[model samples]
Target: MTNDAPLVPRRVLLRTAAVLGAAVTTRLLTAGPAAAPGGPAPSAGPPSAAGPSAATPVRPDHRLRPLAGHAAAEGRRRLPTPVRTRPVLRMPGAGHPMVLTFDDGPDPRYTPPILDLLRRHHVRATFFVCGEMAEHQGGLLRRMVDEGHVIGNHSWSHPLLTRASTAVVRAELERTSEAVERAVGQHPQWMRAPYGAWNRRVFRLGAELGMDAFAWTVDSLDWTEPGTRTIIDRVLNGAGPGVIVLAHDAGGDRSQTVTALRTYLPRLLADGHRFTVPVRGEV
Candidate 1:
């Protein structure tokens, strides 16, 4: 069973508050203008799921905007220089892409069905699996990769990294990466902070681990168990060029997410939003 704790209503409000404080005001972390959402899918073929294992350090991709223009002085610990202070709200210049991301997952109850739905639609999405959750669902993680979905680190226990000690933060991220590597033979290249809470240290440590941070432009709010129609409306209403939509496959009942995706994915695709996953080296 997935060990994730249910995100209560009170916690939801608190977390949302935290994210608004630290995020949403930041600039989009992009290289240049690419195609908008109404453009053709990339010629590179379907989204690639293969990435370096946790042991290998992956460089930050276009999703990150460094706090400064230059690298830090040498002799400092081997961290990714010019770490970001925020997460990528949208994928700029990537071409008419609608990125779908799920957090706190690999839950046996809900994740499989969502995967099935995505497969039926010939779509690929990102799954930010918590380490504790991923450790138990290695098969699901593997299935996600085999089926062309990107798996990213959502931390081990889904704690607020901004409030945890540096050691705790490192352990949370590193342990989760190791779990993912063990399950899928690849470490994540992307991560999303729990509750959207972030600090400079969180960004530096994530970069050190060879991962970039990604926030969302549209939140389905499925975790709240809001009606399926409500979730669909949020996603469809928020749909735009290069928007990253956030949903969840775990942490609680996700039937609404599944049902809502069944409705909205087709609508968005019909409307010319091509579903794709973010990859390193794309600007």
Candidate 2:
């Protein structure tokens, strides 16, 4: 499909401030490198396929469960309604609930292997994909949806929203959401600011755009090109209930990120951690 293709049939209505109800100001969240653009945008590559681990039987559920219910029970509320004062840093649920998220990608080289490994292990993850990248990697986005993974808006260009005007921020978010919906036939319900720099504009704008803002509790530091073992160690070390792990798939050489997952994902599973995607009002 062309980038100029019309929007999906569904109309995304922007919620007015009154409709949004009482507003609250959240603390700004920041981490990792600032003003970093997503690494090389995904280039065209072969259609996605199950990778080397395809031969392995896919586990049903991978002994995991969705954390939305548990989180809801914990009374994690929705955004722009009662209005969140802060982005969610961790998921709440029983049984060592954890979320693994990838940012800035859909890179054909690294993402396919990551997907393959997740498929092989029957694990589901969240990919916060950039619009420039997702626009070209529609197939990857569709595959992510088809496989029951969550796709979130990582902005059109991975800009630091804190530094951008309201219009620029909206465009960054809206364009990315449009790109994703055009590709996968649904709007993203979640969004993350690049480098984790989030301000009131981000929180309010994301809610107006119908997304829950998210920040990570654990930074894998994978984007640093730290050795593969270090990535694995970071993830394993940070493993716990209600933790969101931040890692990357595209931006620079992500071979290390891919390699680390192969080592750590199963270890997480073995340790009785159920990998889950967070739901709105529940994350």
lDDT of each: 0.69, 0.68
- Model 2 quality (TM-score): 0.73
* Candidate 1 local lDDT, 46-153, one digit each (tens): 223243222233332311211111111111133343477778888776354778999987776678889998877777788998887776666667667666677888
lDDT of 1 at 69: 10
User: What residue pairs clash in candidate 2, if any at all?
Assistant: 26-85, 39-251
Output candidate 1 Cα RMSD: 14.1
Candidate 1 colliding pairs, count? 4
List of clashing residue pairs for candidate 1:
34-93, 35-95, 36-96, 37-96
Candidate 1: which stretches are off by over 4 Å? 1-82
TM-score (C-alpha, index-matched) for candidate 1: 0.73
Q: Residue 210, candidate 2: how far off, in angstroms? A: 0.3
